[model samples]
Target: MHHTRLFDSYICLDPSMWWDNQALLKETKRALETRRFHGTSLYLGIANTADEGMDVTRVLTDTTTATLHMRSALQLQRYFEHNQQNGLKYRGKYYQDDSHMSVPFIAEYEALRFLFGAERK
Candidate 1:
């Protein structure tokens, strides 16, 4: 799902959402920035690894280890949000109470909803 365009809809769950120093995130951003895709869709379900009470703005600027994973996720999410000029339809969700270990199940459920054109809420 991550590499192929065979399917129109795809789901991403952490820690696949990130790699050391956010290599995958950067690569994905570059692809989205450079290439134009049509009839393709992406869904990212990011686990909330941020420290308690830390919001996305704060996490992205935090240099501590605690926010590293989540900061990357938020960065990717922010990228997917603002950069839609490439015609890649996308959606992202931050599970505030879910950890990386437990996010997949619910994320898949939400992904199904997105793929089926249901309400985000």
Candidate 2:
């Protein structure tokens, strides 16, 4: 989720701007590449949002993190399926009947449940 937003702001919106800041990009990439988690790390991405901009290939190959992406079929810009096909774990929750604004309420709840269903807390 954070990655997607950063990608959109730093890459998609202005690639030249991002390229000009090579040092920043290198630092960020290094940080992302070296991150280690003791327990489990989970990512949750939502459709009609910044989720589509995420680099799934880099994420899957660079780290052994697990991600659960959800989206609505009704949202024309949603591209979670394509990224999922490229190797990201996807939990299909096609909110075909729901509008973009309504998806977050349901999707966020589903994300929390998916992430912590096994927890005693």
Model 2 TM-score, all chains together: 0.31
Alpha-carbon error at 102 in model 1, in Å?
2.2
Whole-model lDDT, model 1: 0.81
Could you tell me every candidate's TM-score relative to the true structure?
0.84, 0.31
Best by TM-score: 1
lDDT of 2 at 40: 32
Query: 3-27, model 1: which lDDT tens digit per residue?
Result: 5577877778864545567788888
Candidate 2: stretches off by over 4 Å: 1-29, 49-100, 118-121
What TM-score, to 2 decimals, does candidate 1 have? Answer: 0.84
RMSD of each: 2.3, 13.1
Q: CA lDDT of each candidate?
A: 0.81, 0.35
Alpha-carbon deviation at 86 in model 1, angstroms: 0.7
Worst 10 residues of 2 by lDDT: 8-17
- List clashing residue pairs in candidate 1: none
